[model samples]
Target: MVEDTQQPQAQNGAQPQVKMQILAQFIRDLSFENAVATKGAPQGEVQPEITVQVSLDARKRGADHQYEVMTKFRVTSSNKSDNTTLFLAELDYGGVFHIEGVPEDQLHPFLMIECPRILFPFVRRIISDLTRDGGFPPFNMDPVDFVALYRQELQRRAQSQQTEAAPAADQRLS
Candidate 1:
């Protein structure tokens, strides 16, 4: 018996077939600090407030069709009333993917959005475990909004470029 390797064509047009495979995934770096342990546990009725920050990066490797995508996560929990930090966890997770048939112009967003979407569950689990082991309740991180995150970063870069270009223009006039 032979496997059906051919993919169905789309209704719109002759779009190239898309193929993506996650070759490897890993925790490139991890750290968790329990501030409560260092400073001594709080007195009574500790209310914890948590904040999470996420960033993404992707780069093409030497091998054809292979790219590396990294997701960085930083989590901090603090006492809501006093702003005292309870715990902090930072993780850098990476995945190597073999992607084919995506047009070059669209590759960056694909890596940033889709690849990290695939890696998010594992990243969440690590944080949950990190918090639990660090003597707090298991911290189930909310799912990251990759599309919004990507858009914000793009906006930030555009704003930064405009600022830099304005400075250069002023220098030329002087």
Candidate 2:
């Protein structure tokens, strides 16, 4: 007699599993600009301050389990003393993903953090390459803390909801 072997389900009768796959990655948009320093400006007088902004967005594809995540980066360099622009770079990189087994309640955080983490290295490389090719030193972006970013976004949303609900509550009380 052959005994059947199968994975046991959780106590709640649901399978506990999570799976994510990247189908493809591509650059949705890329732009680079190099601005000349003011004439007679001390050459390399001071290192320019670089500011980088990052954002993540995700949407469901036509397929049930398929989704697309976009990671965008905007970088700017400027001399604080004179407020002169040095260089600017913007990139919108995207990845197509297939996710399964994640509960609906947890899907948002998973997509925002995990999907972007997978796409960041490629986006970083593109930015570095663009800067170097644009006759400037390669600007490598520091690794982002997606968890922190997600938490901040959650807080922002909570605050906005509270603010919106407060006015409605006030109206009902009046």
Candidate 3:
């Protein structure tokens, strides 16, 4: 007579599974202003320029094996004078993802590419909405290719290391 507890459960293994879900997303901070609006758009015939800066971070959530990915963006648009902040915005967005029984080889790509890909649309919407509310036409970011972006970033870092090494080599030669 075999004990009921001795019976194997669900394929005799821990069961391969992967689940990625967004826990929450919100604007940690947002600021927008049109200083030139009161000045009637100002004169001097200067073309408008917008600068965008983006940053991303990821961390593990303790023993649960869960992960959190946070992405932030800062965009500022102004005339040549730089005194007017035509459109300025700062957004902090993140998501909580659960991954289990996934192979190590696939984990890197899942976090770098898939996770950010999922969170990007929400972040983009926030930027668009903020621009519209600031009295300017909606400023929508172009769709990002996380796979390509990640590859490019890796390449950039590699090149930067090579450049840094070159300087050290030059010092040795001198």
- The whole-model lDDT of each prediction reads 0.92, 0.89, 0.76
* Candidate 1, residue 76: lDDT: 94
Model 3 — which ten-residue stretch has the worst lDDT?
2-11
| Tens-digit lDDT track of model 3 for 43-95 | 66756677878777778887476888777788887776655656677888888
Ranked by lDDT, top first: 1, 2, 3
What TM-score does prediction 3 earn?
Answer: 0.72
TM-score of each: 0.89, 0.88, 0.72
* Candidate 2 clashes between residue pairs 3 or more apart in a chain or in different chains: none
lDDT of 2: 0.89
32-59, model 1: which lDDT tens digit per residue?
9998999987777789999999989999
Better of 2 and 3 by TM-score: 2
Candidate 2, residues 57-153, lDDT tens digits: the string is 9999999899999998999988877777888899999999999989899999999999999898898899999999987899989999999999999
Model 1 reaches what TM-score against the true structure?
0.89
Q: List ranges where model 3 is wrong by over 4 Å.
A: 1-17, 37-40, 44-51, 79-85, 166-174
